[model samples]
Target: MKGWLPFAGGMLAVVLGAVWTLQGLGVLDSGSVMDGVTLWAIVGPIVAVAGVVLIVLAMRARGRR
Candidate 1:
């Protein structure tokens, strides 16, 4: 229960980041301002990576206990 927060947050971030990346790349149009935005294209992958890192850290911490 204690470790679920980061894991859940990370999962959400990852999913959102993927969507943002696709939208920014003009691959997944959603009729939003973020669509085809260059900044989101760049930022998306970074956010996704951060989320992955968070997930990994959370898993590692849980494993050590």
Candidate 2:
């Protein structure tokens, strides 16, 4: 397999995490309760990092095969 699932999922996570981070930081406006909550500002980066790690693992798996 080419690890397409992980690659795509990671990309999605990166996008969502960035949005959440922006919203939590009040850098972006949104109606959701999570907006400007401050908690997501910290959590968002962690999620983004996890996504990047997932992407890296996916690439490594692809390269191996």
Candidate 3:
């Protein structure tokens, strides 16, 4: 169960980041304040990349164990 935590968190982060990115870019508009926001556009990718790193680290740790 411990091993799955980071994977799950990472997946969630990736999905949310993608949504935020799209919304920020105005590509997935939902009438929210975040839509077309440049800050989210920048932040989303960073979050997504962090998530990817987390996933990779988790995988590596599991492999080592």
Better of 2 and 3 by TM-score: 3
- Model 3 Cα lDDT, one tens digit per residue, 1-65: 55588888888889989999999999999999999999999999989988888898788878887
TM-score of 1: 0.93
**Which sections of candidate 1 miss by over 4 Å?**
none
Q: Estimate, for each residue in 1-65, the C-alpha lDDT of model 1 and write its tens digit.
A: 66778888889889989998999999999999999999999989989998998899889878988
The better candidate by lDDT, 1 or 3, is 1
Across 1-65, the per-residue lDDT of candidate 2 in tens digits comes to 77888988899888888988998998988888988999999888888888998899999999999
lDDT of 3 at 53: 82
Alpha carbon lDDT at 63, candidate 2: 92
Q: lDDT per model, in order?
A: 0.89, 0.89, 0.89
Model 2, which residues run further than 4 Å from truth? none
Model 2: weakest 10-residue lDDT segment is: 1-10
Please report how far candidate 3 places residue 57 from its true position, in Å. Answer: 0.7
Model 3 misplaced regions, further than 4 Å: none
